[model samples]
Target: MITEQAPGKLYIAGEYGVLEPDCPAILVAVNQFIRVSITKTNSAAGIIHSRQYSQDSIHWVRRGFKMVIDNRDNPFEYILAAISYTERFCLEQHVKMKLYDLHINSDLDSSDGKKYGLGSSAAVTVATVKAILRFYNVPFSNELVYKLSAISHYSVQGNGSAGDIAASVYGGWIAYQTFDKNWLKQELNHKTLSEVVSEAWPGLKIQLLTPPVGLNLMIGWSQQPASTSRLVDETNANKAALNGEYQQFIDFSRQCVLEMINGFENKDIHLIQKQIRVNRQLLRHFARINQIAIEIPRLSKLINIAESCGGAAKTSGAGNGDCGIVIADAQTDVTALEQEWRQNGIMPLDLHVHQSKIKQ
Candidate 1:
């Protein structure tokens, strides 16, 4: 059996702002992960299983580089894309490929089956890419895995900076600048997937960072699932109307990204806290200016509670409701904050920075 796992991530800074080309963001891998299990199969058939899907399994026949499914609803479309694209990479390198039974599971949810907005799809895509490459005995590096995951994920979603995908593939914390996703997607249309996979990705940037010493962190989930896609679409629709405000927001967001990297590099808590506060305020301003609820009642309460507890906190992802990040020293009484979170029906996750990249 060939098994690969990729961790989910938290956006430290530059959430909405990273969408712009060449803009940077910071992300950290969390302990939760999407795990894929694979075993070679006979009879030229491929089986893919995922509990999150409606049908839970895709029974398909593999003919050369194509996969044919008889079902109406395609649950493993992203997985299929990864396999097809990886096959392309192999074709260029002259590697052998075979059919396999793949089972994917994730630890990114509450015990009650609630998602914590941990970028499960990105993690799954990263894991699938690595697993497929391994099945073919193809030599791959972390950079190769990151590239394949980025392309495979973009092939499905079309949007996203893919900071989540990079965090999943490279692990630890990273300062990430996304490639031009639209440019890469255009290649999928103009050329074969194999040909595209063989070329280098233009404008991709990923740099790993070491966390500051003596830093304490906490994450609280509001138990609300936010569709990042919907949020980005709605926000993008208003970008033209709020051009001035958008530019201001992006500038400050880029500053926060730099400050975050500076803090990690210098091991300076003051810099980290300052950037956290400023970034939160900027997001609040953006929310009000654009008429989008980037921070909700519950998340606002969480931030307030963290501030009162001597920690700086902010909404992590596309906001509205998902999870928030809290930063403080080890001496702070997070016990009280956790209790308060539970009282408000928020779940405090026992999540920490996952240090390793994708593992087999």
Candidate 2:
């Protein structure tokens, strides 16, 4: 039997700007996760099972009906996608494999009426690619797995930088640069880019706060589904209008990132909190990527609530109906905030900044 797991993630900085197709973004791996465990049956058929989800069946076969998400579509489709892609690649490259039973699972509980956002999705991809490689006894670098996972995600989720994928896989505070589409090559080696911009200081501490009661952490649905296709279209349409704004926002992010780094290095809680608030505002201005307002009033209210408690808050993903991130003092009473959110039907999470391992 083969089992695998990966951590969910949050895009702490850089969302819309990475769409330039040239620039890179930064993300962090939160504590949430998606795990997979599987054992191949010698019955000439590959089965897929997700205990987290009460659905299981023959997902792939050697000669019978082909396994596909549309047929076995569960939360594990992304994982299978990576597996399928890797399998095909391995076949083409003649990578050998042994048959084994497979079981897939995830610690992320989005179906529990809790919203951890897309971090689980990224985690699935990371874990899937890793599992597949291990099952085949293939020797691949972490960078290679990250790239493969990114490619698999792009195949299904349209356009997304491997930045979040990188953070989830590498587990650290990384400065991501542009990635090459060729999974064999592109890696998030932001240290090189940082050296290019080395004048921006070095030590930066990014603190993520998860309220105990889940108050102040809300996911607005926009009450309307915004498909990736439509969002990408609008993004392309706004290109001309966004060029200068993008540059300005990037500059703002860079500067604020510097301040954050300095504050973290100096251990200045007041300065870090203030700069986080400022960065949150700047990111919000750049992230309004939709036509309908995603309950800005509610979001604003939450921000105000957090601010009143001596913390900072902002939208975590591509806004217009996504998760919000809060930065609070280490000693802030998160339970009180969580209680408030629970009353409002919102559940908060304890986001973690995972340690990064750079084996150069």
Candidate 3:
């Protein structure tokens, strides 16, 4: 049996802007993870099981290099994509194929199955790819895993920046710039997966970052799930309507993220906190111009309480609802802040940054 896990992620800065190619974002992999375990099976068929899905198990078989799943209602789209892509790479490497039962479990969601917007789907995709590669005894690097997982995820979801995939594969804190999806799509039409993975993707960049010493990162869950894809689509639909304002947002967000990255490089906590406030204000302005509610009432309350307690806070992701992140000094009164958050129906999550064991 081979088991692999990928950590879930939360965006620290650069949300909507990261969707554009070359625009940067800051994200951190959290302690929560999605694990995929694969074991060889004697039978011709392989089964996938996950309690998070409505179906208990789905049986699948290999039919001339293609996976034919028996169930019509499939909730394992990302997993299936990851498996298919990894197997294709294995075929390229002349690796033998075998039937196996793949089991998945996640710590990224609440006990009641509520998503905390910790990028569970991305984590699952990365874990699935890693597990399958390990099963085939393939030598893989973190970059290889990230590229393969990003391809699989984008193939299934068809939208958004793949920063989550990078965070899952690399772990810890990272400054990420998205690759040009249109260019990738064009390359996929004629290029092999291995060839694409070997090439330098346009506008793609990833760098590991070290947080300042004595920095306190806090996460608060609003108990409501938000559809990131839906929110992104809605915002994009209004880009032409917002005209020059949209471009301005993209430019300002890029600058804000760059400044925050500098803060990390210099180990300046105050500068980081200041940029957090600037990014928050930038997002609010973007929300106002787009006429969307990125900062919901509960998220606003979460931020207000955190700021009052001497921390910098902002909505973590797409932000219609989900989590809000705070960066504060070590001396801040966390207990009092969390108490206020709880009073306002916010659940303070006990999450820490997850460092990857993979060699850089």
Candidate 4:
């Protein structure tokens, strides 16, 4: 049995701009993760199973915030895409064999009538590659693991910065620089990142607020898929249209990152709230890149509400439609505010960062 696990990530800074290659971003591994267990079987075709989805006969099972699937065409299209690429490296080294019965499980859920902002797709890919490595008993370094995982992530997410995968593999706070097409990993390193990781993460304190049942969380859904590929292609086509603007966004994002880093260093709740407010405004720049007709309203309101409660909040993922993140002081009145938000049809989730080594 080969068991591999990968941590889900929260992007503290530099998201939309990092969609373009060569834009640095900051991301950290959270307590949440996806775990995969591969049990080798002597069979012609591979069999994938998920314990989270309990109905064994059903190919797809949906429960409260859980979607589990067995076997279907393209059952794991994104994961297999990454596995195939990773296997290329293995094959080049003359490794050959076919193994079946790969079981996947995750903490990310989109089918429970809700979406969390954490990158489940990226987490799954990271877990898949790690599972493959474990199954092959390969003693690869974290750098190589990150390399293969990033390739898999881009295969599905497109033009990614690899920050999320880096956090999952490295298992800590990481100041990630974006990948430049012409630049190798060694050239674009930033020095302050080390200082931030060493000094900031150790001192930072956070509180995650989880709301009660039957409460509504404000979510903005375009009801349309925002293909990461289309976003990248659009930016590439209109280099004159958005390149400069995106660079500015990247700069602002980096500034916010620095601010948050300093806030952590100082444990200043006020400064953190201020930076989160700025981050939300900068998210608007993503609208043009995603080809949206207007800004998402419900999301905007929820963020305002959270801000009113002495915290700052923002969308968690590619936007268009997804969950949001709320950063508040440890002493914030989350229980009362959660009740208020629920009465107003908003759900609150208490998400916290993990300090221990993630289990497989």
Q: Using TM-score, give the best candidate's number.
A: 3
* Best by the lDDT measure: 3
Q: Local distance difference test, per candidate?
A: 0.82, 0.56, 0.91, 0.58
- Looking at model 1, the pairs that clash are none
Could you tell me the lDDT of residue 95 within candidate 4? 72
Q: List model 3 lDDT by residue over 34-108, tens digit each.
A: 999999999979999987765435556687999976431233888999999999999999999999999999998
In the range 1-360, model 1's lDDT, one tens digit per residue, is: 999998999887788889887678888899998888999888678788877554444445676899976331232766777777777887777876677799988898666566688887788888998898888888888878877887877766667788898898888889998887677868878887566766777777788888788788789998886667667877889999998889989888888888888998999887888898898998899888888888999899988888887888999989988899988887567889898889988889999899884433
Cα error, residue 91 of model 2, in Å, equals: 3.8
Residue 261 displacement (Å), model 1: 1.2
Model 4: runs farther than 4 Å from truth? 20-22, 50-75, 93-96, 110-115, 182-239, 285-295, 355-360
**Candidate 4 residues 1-360, lDDT tens each?**
878887777765556656544444556677777888888787678877665444423245576789965232122665787678667656655677567577888785545423364666677777888788777766566656666776566555545566667777776555566554333323214422222212222111222222222222223222333333334455556656766676777788768766766665565656766776687777776565646522356566566666676556776555554455666665455566566666665565445554434332
Residue 247, model 2, lDDT: 74
RMSD in Å for all candidates = 5.8, 8.5, 5.4, 9.5
In model 3, which runs have C-alpha deviations exceeding 4 angstroms? 55-75
What TM-score should be assigned to candidate 2?
0.72
Q: What does candidate 1 score on TM?
A: 0.89
